[model samples]
Target: MSLGSSKELAENKIILLYMIDKVNMPVSNHHITKLVLENKFMNYFILQQFLNELCDSGFLELSENGGKSFYSITPNGKKTLEYFVNLIPFGIKSIIDNTIPEIRSDIKKESLISADYTPKSENEYIVSCKLKEDNFTLIDLCITVGTKSDARTICENWKNNPQQIYSEIIASLTRKRDKTNRDKDKDED
Candidate 1:
């Protein structure tokens, strides 16, 4: 599984970039391994080598969490990814674009994709996606809603009442369910 040459690395770079962009998320080495295994025609060692080369080139960044390495796109890597994505044939891109999202959504619904949001304080919550290593955390916060005044109020209220934030999400879901039930009844009538 020696990458041994630049041409091999370049080929791998193309495939890896395509896979990453297609998924639209940071991917772990395990995920890449699985993809390579499924393809059968691809050389796993070559893929690994390409990944290393990309990291060296600053096109990708690797974070170790737990014991595994997770690879994320850097700004330069994103530019390279876009270049490869555009090279995809239109028909092939159409099929992949249509199918990949459905697959990713199903995986997320199954909780295969790690996601968690924790309330830190009123008007603030810690939102993170689990990476491969415990120390490597992708954390962000969301505040405000709507536009102009409505957005300002949402942010102000959220800051004042943290617990209410969670409750609001629940309330929204409940309202949606009740509305759906009423619609079903009306349809039946």
Candidate 2:
């Protein structure tokens, strides 16, 4: 499909809207681009242009968090999609449907675990790691390290092993003191 044709352009826009609406959540641009490109639906530049145009025309809303752009369908976008979804080819729609579950899983995982680091001084840095669900933060851990490399390593480790780390931390914090050791200490005293 060539971009010069208005019909093809409109269909592409509808395709974008349909994907976002069906996904039923705020989807990051990176996720959308990956889906579209992996399916050979469009090239990177064209996909980006369509996204910007959609936002400009009130068809989609853009929100940014943690340096990632998330797109969600606006009411107008949903209405327009409802009217024009037929323009999108059945094969394309099928592909999108097949991929939605994986996309949802990825988005959920991405949103749940987050880590970042900022420099506090020439030799000091603070790393923040979080586990969140919806708007609730289950854990927000901050650690200060003496070097940028250490901060970066901590952030990377947190992202890669958040569940294990969270479990370990919880276990350590909640573990009961050894009763035998306490009794022995009392006896010694």
Best by TM-score: 2
Alpha-carbon local distance difference test for all models: 0.59, 0.92
- Candidate 2, residues 1-189: lDDT per residue as tens digits? 456689989998999999999889999998899999999998899999999999999999999987888999999999999888899999999999999999998999888999999998999998999998778998999888999999888888988998898999999899898999889999999
Query: Candidate 2 — worst ten consecutive residues by lDDT sum?
Result: 1-10
lDDT of 1 by residue, 3-105 (tens): 4566545555766666666776656777667665665525777677778888899988898764557777788987876666655446544655565575565
- How far residue 172's Cα lies from its native spot in candidate 1, in Å, is 26
How do the predictions measure up, each by TM-score?
Answer: 0.45, 0.87
lDDT comparing candidate 1 with the true structure: 0.59
